[model samples]
Target: MKKNRFLIILTISVGLFLLSFSLSYQLITNKSEDNKIAKIENNKLENDDKNVEIIKEEEKVSPNTIIEQRILYKECGDLIVTNQTPSTDIINMTKEKYENYLTNKKPFLRVISFSSNKIVTWGEKEHLCNKHFIIGEEDGKIAVFKIGEDGERLLHKIFVDYPVELLMELDRDEIKKGIRVDSEEELSDVLENFIS
Candidate 1:
C-alpha cells in the first residue's frame, strides 16, 4: 500500500514540474518577441524623422524649383541631344499645347516621350537622311545628297534629269553655294516644284 502511495506522489510532482517549465519557456519567448516589435517601431520612427529633415532642406535650397531638361530628337537612325532651360513662354504653356509648340519649331519632329531630364522625339525618315539634304546637279541630273553627321556629303540618289535651265532657276550662288533642305519631305517638295 505504501509503495503505491509513493508512486502517486511522484507522478503528481512530475506533472507540476512540467507545467511550471512550460509556463517559464512561454514567458521567455513572449518577452523576446515583444523586444523585436519595439525595435522595429523605433527604426521606422528614425527613418520618418530623416525623411522630414530632407524635405526641410529641399525647401530651404529652392523654394521655387527651376526645372532643366535635355531634348533628345531622333529620326532616320540619328539622334540629337541638347540641354535647355525652358523659357517663360514654354513654362506658361499648357500641357496639351506643349508638344504643339515643340513640333512647330521643328515640324519634322514629333514628340515620343516627355520624361525626367529629357524630351524624346522622332521625325520623318529618308534613306541616308541625316536631317540635312543637299540638292545639286550631278552627272547631268538633279541629284539628292545627305550631309552626314561627320559633315561628309554622301550621295543619296538622282531625282530627275535637267539641263542648265534648272540650275539657272535657282539663286546664281545657290548652284555654287549648295542648297540645303531641312527634311526628306521638303526635298521631294522642292523637286516637285522644279519639275512643274
Candidate 2:
C-alpha cells in the first residue's frame, strides 16, 4: 500500500510538470508569431516611404542645364520644325507640367517633349491662306482657332461669358464657321458679328 501511494504521487507530479511545460511552449510560439507580424508591417512602411521619395526625384528638374528644344509651328500647308536653345525658365519645368500648360493653350505652346535632339512643343495655327487666325461662336461663346492647311480649324482661344443675346444675333455662315483675314485688325472686323 505504501509503494502504491508513492507511485501515484510520482505520476501526478509528472503530469502537472508536463502540463506547465506545454503551456509555456504555446506562449513562446504566440510571441514569436506576433514579432514576425510586426517586422513585416515595418518593412511595408519603409517601402512606401522609399516609393514616395523616388517619385519626388523623378519630378525634379535641373534648373541650369541647357537641353535640346524645338517647336512645331504650322505654316500654310507645311509644318515648320524649329530648333531652339532652351531658356532658363523652360529648363526649370518638367516636360509633363509644361505640356499640360500648353495642351490646347494659345499663342504658342510652352514645350512638348525631349527626344533625338528635339525638345518638344507645338501650336497648330494655319498659314495656307492670308488669314493668320480665325474667330467664330462655339459652345455658347465666341472662340478663335488656327486652321491647318487642310482647312480644319484647331482650337486656339475662347471667350468666357459672352452675352447670349449678342450670340443670337449672328447668322452669317462666314462668322459661324470662321472668318479669314490677314491680321488681328481684320479678325476684329469679323468679330463685330458677335458685338454691337
Candidate 3:
C-alpha cells in the first residue's frame, strides 16, 4: 500500500511539471514573436516617414504651373498709377487728360517709385545707382526706368519682356546661379538671352 501511494504521487508530480514547462515554453515563444512583429512595424513606420520626406522634397524641386497674380503700382512724383484705377474719376479720365498728364513733365523732382505685392527681385541692386525706378509695361513691352534723385535726369530706360513663365523660370535660374543684374543694361542683356 505504501509503495503504490508513493508511485501515484510521483506520477502526478511529473505530469504537473511537464504541463507547466510546456505552457511556459509556449508563452516565451509567443512573446518573442510579438516583439519581432513590433520591431517590424516600427521599421515600416520609419521607412514611411523617410518616403514622405523624399516626396515632399521632390514636390519642392518640381516646376509648379500655378500662375500667381500680383498688383504693381508705379509712382511718379505725386501721382500713383496701377493697371486698375483706384477711383472712378481716374477711370473716367478723358484721353486728352491722360495725354496731358503724360506730356506735361512736372518741374518738381521726378522721383519714380514702384510698389508691388510681388517681391522685388532686382530693386536693391538698382537702388544703388538710382534713388527711384519704375517697372511696368509700356507700348506692350515690359520696361524699367531709372529716375535721378534730382528728378531731372532719366538715367536708364530698359525694355525687357518674355513669356511670363519664361520670365519666372529665368528668375529662378538666376537665383540658382547667384546672378544679379545691377544695371539696366545687364537686365536688357539677360532678357534678350532668355528671349532668344
Candidate 4:
C-alpha cells in the first residue's frame, strides 16, 4: 500500500508539471502571434497608397484613377542635423534610432550634417541644404544630405530620437532655397541644382 501511494503521487506530480509547461508555451506562442498581427496592421497604415495619374485617352480613365497626383510625404518628427559626415557607425546608430522612433508615439531624431548634399525623404516637407549644418523639425524622421563644394552629395535618413549633445556641437543654417515649386518642371530644376 505504501509503495502504491508513493507511485501515485510521483505520477501525478510529473503530469502536472508537463501540463503547466505546455500551457505556458502555448500562451507565449499566442502572444507572439498577436504582436505580429499588430505589426502587420501598422504596416498597412503606413503604406496607405493611392493610384497614380497619367495623361491618357478618355477611354483609359476609370473611377479608381487618381486625378490629382498625391505625394505621400513621410510623417515628420523633432530631429536635428549635424555638421559631421556620417560613418558606418553613424548609419547603424541612426537607422536603429529611426526604427525605434517610428515604433513609438513621438521621438526626436539627431542627424549628423555634412556640406553640400540633397537628402530626399517621404516626409511632409522636403528639406535641402548646401552648407554643413543641422536643421531641426517637429517631425521625427529626417533625411540628411551632405554636398561638398565640388558638388558631390550623399543622402541618409535619421530614424530615431538621439540626445541633444550629439547634435548640439554642429552648426545650423536655416536659409531656405526653392524646395517647394509649383510645378514638376521647376522641381526638376531644383533637383538639378541640388545634384550639381
* lDDT tens readout by residue for model 2, 104-132: 44345564454323455555653444346
List, residue by residue over 1-196, the lDDT tens digit for candidate 1. 9999999999999999999999999999999999999999999999899888443311111222233332233333554544455665665444346568866775656656553344445554343346688886666666678877446678888755554355565543464455778887888887776555
**Model 1 superposed RMSD (Cα):** 11.6
What stretches of model 1 exceed 4 Å from their correct place?
1-79, 82-129, 169-172
Report lDDT per candidate.
0.62, 0.62, 0.45, 0.39
The worst-scoring run of ten residues by lDDT in candidate 2 lies at: 64-73
Q: Each model's RMSD to truth, in Å?
A: 11.6, 15.7, 22.1, 27.8
64-90 per-residue lDDT for model 4 (tens digits): 322221122222222333223333322
Once superposed on the true structure, which residue ranges of model 4 sit more than 4 Å away at CA? 49-196
Every model's TM-score: 0.33, 0.30, 0.28, 0.25
- Clash count (model 3, backbone only): 1
Q: Residues 120-165, candidate 3, lDDT per residue (tens digit)?
A: 1111111223434444334434445554644333525434444334
What lDDT is reached at residue 48 by model 3?
92
RMSD of 3: 22.1
